[model samples]
Target: MILLRSGAFFPLIVMSLAFASLVLASLVTGAANVSFEDLLLDPEGSSLLLVSRLPRTLAALLAGASLAVAGVIMQMLVRNRFVEPATTGTGECAALGLLATTLLMQNSSILAKMAVSSVTAFAGSAVFLTLAHRLPPTQPLLVPLAGIIYGGVIGALTNFIAYEFDLLQYISVWMNGEFSGVMQGRYELLWASGVLAVGAYLYADRFTIAGFGKETATGLGLNYKSVVVLGLAIVSLITSFTVLTVGIVPFVGLVVPNIIRRFKGDNVRATLPLVALTGGCLVLASDLIGRLINHPYEIPASTVFGIVGTCVFLWLLYARPQRRV
Candidate 1:
């Protein structure tokens, strides 16, 4: 416990420092090279800074934090460290909803598309939870495997529809993660995830107890069903908001939380704040490196994360010991 707490606490401080550096880098290191002097001295430059870089940095931080928290909550709820919004079909459902809105409505705005996407993603999460309830609880891997299979089916259906309708390009652009386009008024949807993250912190204990098992949680006087539903709802909201704003940044929800738990233990309540901070730092770092590596071109933050996370995941798989749960 002492080691875990120490490990958990120190990373938060480091993450905070890294986050600040990344934000500063994001503002100054862009293609235009808007300096601090330009931001302070010129009105038009100041507006550009506020309108462009500030919002994008904020969006990246919020998206990272929200997705990380959602991942932690989901791992607790399903008792599976590998499970995440993307793996569980929430992202695909959101994409389907957005695609449907664009095809059916013909004149739907981004907000309208996001609203529909959020609703559908919530429904998809509900389906996963329901399936979880019906299945005989066994190993943690089985639960996430079910979710992965479910998500795969949904994703395939989505791809088929997009192909049939000749909207593959639109789907392709939206499905892959990209932060280059974020600006003021465009990334506000991510604020919803911030709200949900707060709610998750408030109910962290319930989630911890619920993770012990439904019967155990019930015996402990916690409302297991309600807690599970609340956690799922938060995950759905976070996932949908992220998909709508920056597209799918896969493995964040799955990888970050698991990595945190190795050092912090499975104390969801105590670990959430650190998870959020570390997630933000990781994303910001990835975004900054992506920008610098290609100089003027800029790689997607998601691509960086994917490469880094896959390696980490492989290491974990190799090092992980078999356990009796």
Candidate 2:
């Protein structure tokens, strides 16, 4: 009951309501009826709800929370507000790893794909951060822009390789974040993202200090490098898990954490759950809106979120005027 008295309670209540509403809507909006009543009275609806609808809802929630927590860790690690797996070449690198595994082993297990992707993602993130610090740091936008370009190059290379191997169609299926294809057996891997989210909560204070940069962190008796590596590992695992389970969902990471940071002022532990809830809610809302707009045939959650995220990104970038030379 003390939770109800806490400052976080009201926001939690609002977010929980939103989350519940979205879950309910998603449960019922598919090709068949999956209402609560159907769960009790109709075996078919019960089966569908259990195997498909429930799993998809959980996937969205897990993916959203993982990515958002990852975004928070990343921004703190690099001290850059705008970087995310999609922008920072992490997703592209993971995709590249996926393609490589497909070509090399052809029938590799999902775990193999995840392992390769996580390795490549760690390397990619390392390169981005190294390059980011090497460049003149006059402009804050420099790092994100570079990361976007790098990710684009990686993406283009991935596409070329896919085209050569006649794997473009398969690659396309995994490039975008879409929940339409989610079913129980396929989505259980996303549970790893939930575990990673909890880990983020545990390391929240360390990341908070690391964001102050090496000198300050070292001064405070912290091993900055270890903290960053742990953070990167978390991000990599989260990214690879999502890609393997539901393809790459962009912007949930980039947008949700930034909004929370702006309003809550970077108290990650306190805001961690909020970031997770808001991110999941945003993706859930996107999925719901897509379901309603097209009815039986639905748009990908990625497409809807892409639009929403792009708008929020623009606002964050240019909402306030900047003085240029």
User: Which candidate number has the best lDDT?
Assistant: 2
Estimate, for each residue in 1-325, the C-alpha lDDT of model 2 and write its tens digit. Answer: 7867766478778889999998888787887756678865798878888898889899988888889998899888878888888889988888888999999988899889889989988898888888877767577798899999999999999999999999998778778989988998999888989999999899899999999989999999999999989999999889989888888888888999988777667778989989999988898788878887878889889999999999999998877634334
Clashing pairs in 1: none
Question: Could you tell me the TM-score of candidate 2?
Answer: 0.95
TM-score of structure candidate 1: 0.91
Report the number of the highest-TM-score candidate. 2
Off by over 4 Å in 2: 1-8, 320-325
Give the local distance difference test score of model 1.
Answer: 0.84
Q: What is the C-alpha lDDT of each candidate?
A: 0.84, 0.87
Residue 69 in candidate 2, Cα distance off native in Å: 0.7
